[model samples]
Target: MTDKKQPRTPGAELPDHPKFLWDSPEPKRSYDVVIVGGGGHGLATAHYLVKNHGITNVAVVERGWLAGGNMARNTTIIRSNYLWDESAGIYEHALKLWEGLEDDLEYPILFSQRGVLNLAHTLQDVRDSRRRVEANKLNGVDAEWVDAATVKEICPLVNISADIRYPVLGATYQPRAGIAKHDYVAWGFARKAAEAGVHLIQDTEVTGFLTDGDRVTGIRTNRGDIAAGRVALAAAGHTSVLTDSLGIRVPIQSHPLQALVSELLEPVHPTVVMSNAVHVYVSQAHKGELVMGAGVDSYNGYGQRGAFHIIERQMAAAVELFPVFARAHLLRTWAGIVDVTPDASPIVGVTPYENLFLNCGWGTGGFKATPGLGEAYAHTVATGEPHPLIAPFSLDRFVTGRLVDEHGAAAVAH
Candidate 1:
C-alpha cells in the first residue's frame, strides 16, 4: 500500500479559497495606514501596529494571494549568530519572538530549534567563525566555537574530509537557531492583524503612489485608489516599482534565489549545515525530506525559474558534505525574487519621502528577521524614528558610508 504520509504529487493543486482571506472589505478610499504588501512583513507590521502601538487603521494591499511572494517562498532558516553586534541583537530579538509566537498569536507556528551550524572548512573560515562567535556573545547571544571533533560528535554523518578542496576544520553553533513553519507564520500574523481591524486586500495591486511634493498622500491600485495619511512599502521584490513612481530611487537589486527539496526518506540531518565556500546549505524537513538551497542567479532577471546548473552545483556540494544524499531523488524546485542591497543588509525606517516608510532590501535573510523587522518597522511608522534595533540599517547609511557590513557572517546564511 502507498504510504499516506508521503507528500502529495508535485504541483498538486489545493482547494483555492485564497489562503488566509480577511473578512473585512476595502474602504472606498481612505485608511490611516496603508501598507503595500500582504506578505509576512506587511501582515506582521499590521499586527504590531494594532497590538503594540494601538494604531489599527491599516490596510495591507497585495496584488495576489496573501504571502504569495517571498514570505511563502523561503527555506525557513532562523538564526541570530552574526559577525556584527547590530545584526546579532536584532535577530536575537526576532528569535525570542519566534520562541513565543505560538503563545502570542494563539496559532501553531511549529518552530523547530534544530540548531544551525556554520561549518568552517578552512583556516579563514575558522577565524571568521570565531569572530562571529565573539561578536554574538558580545551582543548577548548564545554562540560558541565547536572544533572538528565536536562537529563530528554532533553530526557524525558529515564528511570529515582533509584533502578535499575545502577541508573541514570547525564550526560555529547557535543552539537557538533553527526553522519555523513559513506558511503558518504568515497565516498567524494575517489572522491576528485582520481580527484587529486591519483590512488585508489580496488581488489588489498598488500600481503607483499619489504624492504631493515630497509627501505621499495615498496609493493608486488596479482595484481602486486608496487614500492614506501614511504608507509603508513592505513589498520585497517590487519595491523599486512603487519607489520609482514617487520619483525616488533606492539602491536595491532584484535577484532570483532558488531552493529545492528531495523525496521523503529517513531523517539524516539534525541541524542546519551551512558551507560558505560552497555557497550551499542543507537541512532536513519535519517530513524527512532534505531541503537545500544556494546563492542567487549570477545574472539579474525577473524570471523566478532558475537554470538546472544552480541545482546541479548545489547537489554536488551537498553530496560532498553528506554522501548519504547521493541516492536521494530530487522532488521539486522553486525560486523567489530577492531585493538585495549593496551591503546585503535590510533598509528600514522612513525614506526620503515624508509619509512613505520603507522596509525592504532584506536580501535572502528576511524570513528569520520578520518578527524584529515588523516590530522595528511598526515603531518607525508610528513614531517617525528608527527603533534602536534598526538604527544601524537606515537607508542614509548607504550614502553616508555607515554601512553595517555583516558579510563575514551573512555571506553564507544571511
Candidate 2:
C-alpha cells in the first residue's frame, strides 16, 4: 500500500479542527507559570490555571508533540476505585471532573462510564475487594460488590464458572469507572488553554532548571531559557529525570508498562473486566478492538518497551478469563514509562525547592487521575499551597512515614 504524506509549512494551517493551540513552534520568552510536559497533566494544568485562577500568563513546554507521552500511550482506562482515603480523594476528584469534562472542555472526549468490574478469584482477593467496595461507599465514591453471576451478567464475555482456574468469585464494581479518548482530552485542554492565552510550545525540551538559591526561577530549554515566577513539573515518567537535573531527589522508580489491542471484532465486552488474581484487564473500545494490559515490568528501567513475557502472561489470563477471546488476534503493542513509588501510590505536591512544584509518581494509575491532579497541582502552583484534595499525597509523606499504601488497588489489575 502506497502512503501519501500530508504537506505542511512552519506556520501553515493545521488540519481541520474547531480551534488550534500550536500554530507555530515559537516558545514564549517568559511566563508567570511554566508547565513542563504538554501531556494531559500539563495541558490540563494550563487549562485549570487559566480558567479557575485567571492565570493566563502561562506556557506549556513539551519536548515532543502534544499528548504523545503516556497520555496517548496508556490503555485509556479511567477509574477511582482505590483503597486508601488519600487515593480516593485525588482520583475521585478526577472522576468527578471526567463526568462533565465534555461540557467543561466543549469537546466530545467520549467519556464512557460503562462500569469497571474487578474480579476476585482467591479468598484474600474477595476480602480486599469487599473492604475496598465498602470503603469506597463510605468515602462517597460509588462502588459495590457483585457476585460472579452479576459479573457474568454485567460482562457477558467473562467466564465466571468454577470449572476454570482462578474462577471469579465476586467483583468490586464501580459503576462510574470507565474509559475516555486520551488524545481528545489533551487536545481539548490545549485548545482551551490556548484560547485563554496560554502558550503551547511544542518540540521545546526543558534541559535544566534556572534556580535562585533554593528557588526555581525558570527553565533552561533547547530553544532558549525562559523565565517564570513558578515552575510546575508534570512530566510523569520523566519527572525524576527533570528533578534530578536540579539535584532534587525523590523516591520514584520508573518502570515500563505495556499494552496492546486485538483486531477489530464485534463488540464482545460491554464494560471493563479486571481480574486481579489473573493479572489482566480487558475493555472493548467503540471501534470493537479489545484493549487490554497488565502489571508493569518487574525491573526498573526507562525504556518504553516492556518485557515480552509480561504480555505473554497477560494473554494467557485474557484467554482464561474469556474463552471467546482465545481466537482473537492481537494487534499492535506499545509501552510507556510509569514512575512507581515505594507504596504504589503517587507523590504529588510541593517540593523542597521554593516555587517549584512536583506532580509525579502516578505509576500505572496516572491517566485516571489526570484531570483531578491537574486541577490540584495547578492550585498548588497557583496559590503556592497544596490543595486539600491532594495534600496527603505530598512528597513529605514518604519522609514522614505516612505513606498511603495502595499496592493492590492502584496497580494494573487496571
Candidate 3:
C-alpha cells in the first residue's frame, strides 16, 4: 500500500460519476456490510473487512466528505499509557500499528514518536500518575515514572514550580506514544479501502436502518436504500441519533472539544505534555505549530463549535506552563464533537440488535485507536463475534454495570 503523492490541497470536484461512490443511481442489490460514517473507524473497518476478513461487499456512507468528521478535527496525538490494563493493552497495539502505518498503507502518515509526558502538579496527581505507570507496565506497556528534573530535561520549556497553587512533582513518560498526520491517516485508509474495492460513498447519510425483528437488514440513506447482512454504526458524534432511530438507547453524550494551533515557529516543544490539574494538553505539530486542547464543553450539545472561554482557558494554561507561548500568535482554532460515555472509553462490538455492530463512544481518543479498532471491529462484523482485543468494550457492560473506567487518567485531553 504505497502512498501516492497527492496535491497539497487535495479535494477536487469529481466528474459526473464520482470515483469514490457507486456509479448507478441506487443498487437494488445487497452488500455484505454497510458501515456508517466515513471517518477513521469507518474507513479502517472497510479496509480490514476486505484485507483481513476477505469480505469485499462493503460500503462506507458519510454525510460529509470522507474523513471530514473528528478524524480530520483531532490534535493527532497517539498514546497508550492509560490507567487500566484493557485500555493500555488495546491502545498499545494501536500505537504499534501507527509505527508502520506509512509502510502498511504505503501512505506517509508522518508518525513521530516524540514521547508523551503526563505531568503531576499535586500529591493526588502524583499518586494517580504512579498508579497509571504501574498499570501500564502491568499491561506490558513501557511506561516509566520520571522526576521533575527529568521532565525539565525532556521539555525545557515547561515551568516547573516548587511552590505554586499546585506545585509540579513528577511525570509518567511513554516513549512509544507520539503523534501522526491526522488527514493523512484518514486519506490512507480511504485510498487503501478504495483500492481494495470497498465503496467510499461520501455525502450519503444513513437516515435509518432497515431492520427485520431484532436484526438490521440494511441501511436507508438519503441517496437510496442499500441492503446489508451487517451494519456497523461507526458514526461517532451521531451515534445516539442513529441508535435512537432503531429504538436503541446508548448511554453516550455528544460534547464539543476545542483545539487551537499557534503560528508556526522554531520547534521547541518535543514531547506531548498533559496536566491533570489544569485539564489541558499541548504539543507541537510537524509544521512547528503549537497545538493545544482541553476538556469537553461545559454543557453537552450537538454543535461542533465551542465558546471562546475554552480557548482562553487553554491559552492561559499554555502560557502558565511555558511563558514563551504568551508571545506566540494563535493562528486558528477548531472544535470537534466527541461521543462521550460514562467511563471515557469506547464501546465496540455487538449491540442489542442482531446484525448491528457499534464502534462509538471514543470521546477524545479515537484517532490513535483507529487501526486497532477497525481491525477488531472488522473481525466482529465478519464472524459475528467480538474480538478478544475489544471484548471488554461491549454495550452489555453498561447494562451489567461492568464498565471499563479510564477516567482517572483520561480526565485531561490526551
Candidate 4:
C-alpha cells in the first residue's frame, strides 16, 4: 500500500519498491507445510495458507519453474455455468474470486469479462443448453439461453446459419465469462506467497515420500530430504505419478490438451465462442491474436503434444466456424497433459495416507479455478479437514456414487 502523505509520482517512484518474486536463497530443510507443485493452484494454496491461516512457514517445491505446467498452458477462459449444483457452487465461488483477484493480489491479472457463448448445433444440444442455463440460474450462477441470432450478435464471426453442418440452433451465454492472462495469474499468487515468506524452490523434483507408517512426514527430493509437518499434492496431471509412488491409485487418465494461436490481426471476436458439436473453442486475446483449440487427443499420453490429424481436424473446425480466419497464419501451437477423472470432477480433500492431502483430478477445468481451488486447498491443509467448497469432490465420491459430471459445461474445448 502506498502512503497518501508520501510524495510519489508514476515515473519517480522509489527504486526497489516492488519485487515480483522472492529470491529464495535455499531450501530451509524443513517447513510447516510443503506444497508439492508450483503451478497456479499450488502457489495460490501457499498464498492463502499464509494470508488466511497465518501459516507462513511453507515451502512450494516445483520440479520446474512456477506455472510452467497447465497453469501457463491452458486457454484462460473463466466461467461457472455448469449443469450440477455441486459444480456450480465451486466454480461460482471461483468466479467471485476472479472478480476481485487483481485488487487482492495488487497486480493487474488482465481478466476481461467479455462473455462466453456455448453454441448449440442439434436438438439435443439445445435441450442441454436450456437445461444447463436453468440449472445455473437455480444455483445462482448467471447464465441464459440465447437464440442463434443472439449468438451472432455476441460473436459476429460465428457461422450460425442453418446452411452449415452442425448449424447453431441456440447457445448458452454467460455475460461474466471471459479470459485472463494465465501466467499473470500464476505469478501474481507466486509474488504474494513469496512476499508472505513462503519458500518457492524451483527445479526441485520430488523423487519419493518420506513416510512413517501410513503418514507422510516429508518428501525426498533431488535436492535432498526436506521435512514437513504436512503435505498437499497440487500437481495437476502429475498427480498420477505421485499417487503411483504412494501405492494408491486415483482414477485419472492423462491426455494431451492442445491449443493454437493465429498471427496478430485486427480485433473481430469480442467474446469467447465454444462449439461442442464441432469440438472447437475460440477467443481473441487482448493482443488481437486468435487463441483457439478443439478437443483432446484420443490417445492417453504425457507427451505434451497433439497428433497431427487431431490438430488438422481442429483447424478444419475452426475455419468452418470462422471463414475469415482461413488465411490467418498460424503462429504457435502447444499442449499440456490433463488428468481426466472417472467423474470429470476434481478430488480435493484428505487421502488414505495420514497427513497427506490430495488436490487433483480437475482435468481441463483447473486453470479457471485457480483462486477458489487454492483457498479450499489451503483451508483443508491447514485444518486437516475438507473445506465445504471442496468436500463433495473427495476421492471417496467415486465409490460413494456421487459424481459431479460436467462434460457439458467445462474444459479447454468447452
TM-score of 1: 0.94
Per-residue CA lDDT of model 4 for 1-414, tens digit only, reads 111121111133222435545665599888999999999999989989998999999999999998998888898989899788888888889988888898899976777788889888899988888999998889988899999998888788888767988888989998888888787788789888888888999999998899999999999999999999999998988887888989978899888889888898776788888988788899888677888887777678888765677778889999988888899998888898888887788888999999899998888888888898999899999999999989999999889898888766654353
lDDT (0 to 1) per candidate: 0.83, 0.84, 0.83, 0.85
Off by over 4 Å in 1: 1-21
Please, what is the TM-score per model?
Answer: 0.94, 0.94, 0.93, 0.94
Q: Predict model 3's lDDT versus the native.
A: 0.83
Name the regions of candidate 3 deviating beyond 4 angstroms.
1-28
Tens digits of per-residue lDDT, candidate 1, 1-414, equal 111122233243433445434574755579989999989899889999998899988999989889989988889999888777788878888988888887888777767787788899878888878887887888888889998788878778788778777777989998878887788799889888888888888788888988788889999988878999999999997898888877778888898898999998776677788998878899877667788998877677667775798989989998888887899999999999888888888888888889899888888899999888898889989888889999888889977999887666656558
Candidate 3 colliding pairs: 1-106, 2-106, 3-106
lDDT of 2 by residue, 44-150 (tens): 99999988899999989989888998998998888888888988888898998888888899876767788889889989988989999989888898899999999
Could you give the C-alpha RMSD of every candidate to the true structure, in order shown? 4.9, 6.6, 4.6, 4.9
Q: Write the per-residue lDDT of candidate 3 for residues 1-414, one digit (tens) a residue.
A: 113222122123322423443221233458889899989999999988988989987888889888888988899888888887788878888877777777888767777788889889878878888988888888888889999999999899988877656556999998878787788788778888877778787777789989898889999888778899999989997999999988888889988889989998776788899987877899988777888998888688777675788888889888888887899999998889998999888899998889999988989999989998888899999999999999999888988988999877567764
Give candidate 2's error at residue 228 in angstroms: 0.4
Name the better of 2 and 4 by lDDT. 4
| Two-way TM-score contest, 1 vs 3, winner | 1
Clashing pairs for model 4 are none
